[model samples]
Target: MPTPAATTTDLTGRLAVVTGAANGIGRASAIHLARNGADVVLIDIHESGLAETAEEIGRLRRAAHPMRVDCTDNAQIVDAFQRIEREIKSVDILLNNVGQSARERASEFWCSEPETWDFILKLNLYTAMTCSRQVVPGMRERRSGKIISIASEAAYMGSQGVADYAAAKAGIIGLTRALARELAPFHVNVNAVCPGPIRTAAADRLPIWEQYLKETPMGFAGEPQDVANVVVFFASDQSRYITGQSLIVNGGRWWS
Candidate 1:
C-alpha cells in the first residue's frame, strides 16, 4: 500500500472554514489544513478554546481567524458567515463540523421527550444545512467550492438508543449527496466524514468509555488527527473527482 504522506500536496492559496473548531476533530482538521498551507477560519461557541486553536495555527505561520458563535442559532450562524465572506473573501472549503447530541448518554427514542428529539435534530442536522446555505452562494459565484460534513458511523447502523441522534446524522449524508448533485454544475464538491470511536473529551466523559474500547478491533480509540487527515484530503484538489462520499474512520470495529 502507498504511504499517506506521499499523496498530499501543498494547499498554498486555499482557504478553509471549519466550524465546531474549538476542540476534537474540528481542531485537528484546522491544524492539518494550516500545516498544508491553507488559510483557516475557526468557528465555535467556546471562545477560549477557539482562540487557543487559532494561536496554534498562527504558530505555523498561517492566518487563523477565530469566530465565536452559537452554531445552533440560525441568526448567529448567518451573521458569522456573512462577516467571514465580507472580510476574508469566498470560502474555498466549508467544513460543517458543528454538531452534538443532546446528551452524552443514550436515550431510548420511545421514552425520550419531543423536546430532547428537537434539540438533537437541530444540532446535528440543521447546523450543517444552515451553514451550507450561507456558503454555497459565494461558492457558486466563484464556480468552485467543497463542502465536507462531519457525520457519524451511527448513521449507517441501527444503533440502539439515541434514535434522534442517529436520524439526524443520517440526514447529513442525505443532504451531502443531494447537494452534491445540485452543486456539481458549479464545480462544487460535497462530501461527508463518518468517524467511529474517537477519544475526544466528550467520549472520555462517557460512562462506558472502557466498554467501547473493548469492542474496538484496534483496541484503542482513534485520535482527532486521524480524522483530520481525511478532512484535508476531501478539502484538497486531490479529491476533485470525489463528492457525495462518506468515509468511515472506524478502527476496524463495527458496532450496531
Candidate 2:
C-alpha cells in the first residue's frame, strides 16, 4: 500500500490573487500566502501600497505581481483580470478582501442616503462577485481551486449605523454557500472569513473603535495577521474538506 501524504499547509507553486492587497487584512494575508510558498498577485487601487506589499513578498523569494485596480469599477476589474490571465496564466487561490463600511457616512437606516448605500454595496459585494466571475470558469475547468472572502462579524450580529455594510457582508456569506455547493463537485472550495474588529488602519478610523474593543470578549481587538492566519488555512489543501462555511475570527464577539 502507498503511504498517505502528510496533511500540511504547503502552498508551493500556487498562485494567489488578493484584492485590496494594499493594506490591512489583504496585505497581511497576501504576505502570509507568500510565506507559505505561493506567489501572489496584489490587486488594489493604491499603487504605492501595492508596491510595498510586492516588495515584502519579493523578499520572501516568491514572485509578487502588483496591479492597481479600482475594484468598484467593473471595467477596471475586467481589464485587470484579463491582464492577470495573459500575464500569470492561472490563479489557484483568490482572496476577495476589498471591503469598506463607509463609517464616516454611517447613520440610522432611515437617514442613510441611496448613494451611500450604493457605494457601500458596490465596493463590498459587487466587487467580490465580479472578481469571482473572472476566475470561476478556469477553476471549474481545472477542477481545483479555493475562493476565500473577507466578510465581517457584522453580517451575523447586526450593528447599528452600518446597516448597508452589514447587508453587503451578509450577501458575501450567502454567495459563499451557493458557490461552494455549485463548485464542490469540481473540487473548488468556497468560504468566507468573518472578521470582527481587527486592528487595521480602516478600523482605527471608525468612530466605534472603543466600542468594538469593549465588546470583544478577548478584551481587545485582533491584529490583521490573526485573520491572515485563517486565510492561509482556507487557501491550503489542509482545508480540503471544509467548504461553504464562514469562520469568524473576531475574538469571541459572536459564537457562530
Best by TM-score: 2
| Residue 170 Cα positional deviation in candidate 2, in Å, after optimal superposition | 0.1
- In model 2, the Cα lDDT at residue 30 comes to 99
Candidate 2, superposed: residue stretches over 4 Å from native: 1-4
Off by over 4 Å in 1: 1-7
Candidate 2 C-alpha error for residue 220, in Å: 1.3
Give the top-scoring candidate (lDDT).
2
Cα lDDT tens digits, model 2, 128-170, are: 9999999999999999999999999999898888999999999
Which pairs clash in the backbone of model 2?
none
**Model 1 backbone overlap count:** 0
TM-score of each: 0.94, 0.97
Candidate 1: pairs in clash: none
